[model samples]
Target: MSATQTAPAAASPSPASAPVKNSRGRVILASLIGTTVEFYDFYAYATAAVLVFPVLFFPTGDPLTAQLASFGVFGAAMIARPLGAVVFGHFGDKHGRKATLVASLLTMGIATFIIGLLPTYAQIGWFAALALLILRLAQGFALGGEWSGAALVATENAPAGKRAWYGTFPQLGAPIGFIIANGLFLVINFSSPSREWFLEWGWRVPFLFSAVMVIIGLWVRLKLVESSAFEKASTKGAIRKVPIGTVFRHHWKELILGTFFMLATYVLFYLMTSYTLAWGIKPADVETAQAAADAAGTPFDAAAFFPGGGFAYPEFVTMQIIGVVFFGVFTMLSGPIADAIGRRRLLIWVTLAIIVFGLTFNVFLMSGGSPRFAGALAQAFLIFGFTLMGATFGPMGALLPELFPTNVRYTGSAVSYNVSSILGAAVAPLIALALWAWVGEPWLVGVYLSVMGVLTLIALIIGKETKDVDYEEAGFSSSAVL
Candidate 1:
């Protein structure tokens, strides 16, 4: 019998059997917690890449170059993510979701913890930077499998018409993780007496604290049953022996569409988080500010040095926290709205909105008439960008999985998601920095953002609306050759 035509195995739960509300709730919780831990670990590194890694890991020269180098290391994880997706996607599709998730979690947790203990350039020279790069790769690798698995866990267990709502649970992790990571950094930043001391040791605390979050994630994920969809596929002997190859062979169209469909979302997020942090913390005319502070026998505080040029680090982080709150709120709202209208329809509208926002993004930054004005402008940029991000990103968990058949769902979704990261996220900060330095205009970056939004808009127009599709059906033909 053909794979799709095979009878359901006795070991598998019936696809038609209604999912219990309580069990579905558990799946959501498990998925949310797993993603939260993964992203917290991930974003912690990102924040440090800007605020600490440059000084700690590198032999400092120019601050901007060092910062760019740190961002390059940050991109290393994005570079490794697709490889992780291929490896873990195979296991997830062929073995099971829960097993793969647990393994990914362990890998990420261990790498993050090790990064905290790693020696800096002052202690170990180049070896310190090398170790940081290796650990960053490990973080990328683990996260490759994380998002797709968590998304599947939630969406697969969703009741009829609630997939979008369930999908948002995993999406919620992004804002929560951002808040937690930044909040901890803020606490440490304030409590410490000296910037030198904080840079020396206080930053490591967040990375080390990841151990606790990982333990919690593991405990929750361990309790999760494999999704009924995967179990059903397994029982019917429908699991692809090499899921990555199978997806590439059969689902190439969905893969391409899914990747581009996410371009704007990925670009907007990294731009707002990492790139914005870099821009905001930069001292306005570094030499002038440093000279004034030195003449006064005080250290140059970038936050106060250039009232019209750059933000105080602490003030900018606080604004970002506020923006993240808006991100979280809109993320929750997007789900129910998506459920009401349609994922594709909402995405098209949101992408269009992002294009408009991207074009105007630099106006606020340019209007730094006063410190207060600059801060408000920065907050507006973040709140508006994140609000649009929520609408764009919120539907992705449901949208990606729904695009492919269950047999290759994990591989397909993971590859698409990670590939988009490489395309949009991995190089965004680097590109933004280069644009700002070379062209000397922030609006150019806005134009770049708008271009990505246009790309996504085109992809959405070309792709099918999948919200109404029956996810339980093995949508592919049994006669299809692998």
Candidate 2:
């Protein structure tokens, strides 16, 4: 089943439903837009978890404890993700990808918007914390269903030999969303009259702004026709009554391999964004923090202070934005390369690079030598790390769904991605933070990343290449059904 021979068949319309024919541009746009909103809402929360949530939601005497608790709430959402996957995956596999994508986007947008309006711990007491956790769970659940649908929208609609290339469009959403979310925060942080002003109101802006983004995303998605793959599945009477049962019963190997396959990507993503931001902007020494606290008429606890890169918020974030540019570039590049070679082969090499990158964390992060020298090294670390992030991430959009038939694809891919979130994203920030706090350095966290990368490499070794999957035929041919 060479791709060229099967691709034309995949695109041919069925008599069951007249295909509205999602145009090339429309397919790319719909795929890119939903995930963009998802990530924007997500990164907004991640950023606040570092800058504002600790002080506002999880206030405690010990800075480390407050941060850990804030991140604990952050991780809690990852736990809800798998459930979201099951619920949404069920509907998506049964109903259609278009409606499911719209539902997921709306869920996330509403949750994020309400979080902006919720009272803080000072105003509403622990209820504020409870509300935040519930909303975070909603956000997680929405995202659990969002990625796979978008990936399917792109890859399922893609032309032969170019599935991976079209897949890159959805992956592009991450860097774009990161830049937009953080860039907006950076702007608000700079524009506020004082740090107090920013803390009081500025952080809420990004969350509330998501409503507008959601409206635009919904419009784009509503315009999308069902992907050809889903139509092919449906027209052939392959739609399952319970996709979850079908997936677990028959595609158990894919579920397991796909979960571990995504392990390193999730770990690296959180580490590079959340953990790095937390560590990148901290005061390098207790004396500096105490001095700032004294000037601001705030109490300082020396016991809770930990050294970091010593860079200011603006300076460090600016560097991160620069690194993410390379992320976007390499993400786009990785797809074409994967299309030329194969997903498994490219990923194996990239995983090896990640393993090597993990070992060099101290080389870039150790806070010695002149401040200028240190800043240069930190910038290099971000650039290098995100470059790897893009390479590893881009192929996943096509690769994951290609592992399953169209009938169970929504369930299969979503389950794998979000389940891995529990293993990787759910804990990476906490683990990195704990190791950083315990050892007073970031080298151990890097070692953690390397270990995860090794796990991904093993998954890659065991998995088969799917560049030539006949998506049209993969559905309904299997006799296994629940």
Candidate 3:
């Protein structure tokens, strides 16, 4: 008999057999809150790199070079993420998700708090940057293990028929975290006086405040049980001795496919959040600057594009918070939609939408905005980018878990997800920046995302459909009789 033939039929646990409601809900809650804290810490660094780090930690003779250095440190965390995934995934698969989740959250919180305390280059010279780098690496390492545990928590406890919807609950963390990250900064920015005061201390408030959320996340996570999937898998002694090696041996193609399939999603994220902010702040843009400077407590030439003829970055940062709200609403709706349509299909359509809309949005961006058109167009494109992100990212909660057997689901999905992050998200903002510098135009960067979208579209179209398969029955061919 073939593997499918020998495998038991996919089954859902009944009320008597299913994970009890309180237990499952607690697990989902833990996953959601834990992910929110993790991503909150992660995005806070990303935001600082853009808004404050270039001036604070990496003071330099040239403003441009300082900006590059700030981004360099931001990219460092991405490079560390996959390595963290491998190390943490191994222990997670071998031991349990509960322990791994708690460890990662603690590590992230500590790293972020330390970042808030680091001295600036003015205060401590190069040592400040060194300290920041070390903390960023710690944050990356913790994040590597975070997603896998989140995925497992939601998937393991979900009702079989509603797994896709439940899985999306963990995925909601990205937007929620973004909202909290940007909202905190928005509050600080509004309250501060000059850029001097903001950089002097306001910048650290968000990082220090994370300790409160971390404590809350930890308490919630502690109440959850170890995943039922992990419990069952452990009984069979099926945990891999080394997750990375096992993934390459047994599921190399799927890993590669997932990496490509997720490429466009990450690319769009950088484009909408980081790249748009860059374009808005560059000296060439007059109006965006004027708006920003006014929002700041600074005076400028009213005749200048900005008050002074330079772009103000903080105003755009406020816009990003608004964008996060739109993303949150769209993401919430995408979960049930994915459950109805299937993961693979949703990914394909979204990838196509990104390609088509990405090109059009660039055209709209290049056409200098009129006062009446700017807000509507910008919000529309922001929602467009995030809605595409939502459609693909929402189903991922179910899709990644469904790709692996319960025996090693935690390890396998974590590795693949983080590996995808490295290839797709880790370098995305850097690459887009590099592309723009290389070609001297944003259109070239759009082409880069378009190409990635096409690649991911192909991957989704060619990949096997996974809607109905049970976790244990995943990755087997339908041709194999059960």
Name the regions of candidate 3 deviating beyond 4 angstroms: 1-24, 282-314, 367-369, 472-482
lDDT of model number 1: 0.83
Q: Which stretch of 10 consecutive residues in model 1 shows the poorest summed lDDT?
A: 473-482
- Identify the superior model by lDDT, candidate 2 or candidate 3: 2
Give per-residue CA lDDT, model 3, range 83-134, as digits (tens). 7888778788788877888998899899999899988776676898999999
Structure candidate 1, residue pairs in collision: 303-312
Q: Scored by Cα lDDT, where does model 2 land?
A: 0.88
For candidate 2, lDDT tens digit of each residue in 1-482?
Answer: 89999998799877776647889999999999888888888789899998778767766657888789889999988999999999999999999999999999999999999999988776776788999999999999998899999999999888889999999999999999999999999999789776666666889999999899899889999998887778888988999999999989888988889999899999999999999999888653446434434454334453354357878788898999999999999999999999999999999999999999999999999877999999999999999999999999999998888888889999999999999999999999999999999998899999999999999999999888888778766465332211
Highest lDDT scorer = 2
lDDT of each: 0.83, 0.88, 0.72
User: How displaced is residue 238 in candidate 2, in Å?
Assistant: 0.7
TM-score list, all predictions: 0.90, 0.92, 0.86
Candidate 2 lDDT trough over 10 residues, lowest sum: 473-482
Report residue 160 deviation for candidate 2 (angstroms).
1.2
Show how many residue pairs clash in every candidate, following the order shown: 1, 0, 7
Query: Candidate 1, 108: how far from true, in Å?
Result: 0.6
Off by over 4 Å in 1: 1-22, 282-309, 475-482
As a TM-score, model 3 comes out at 0.86
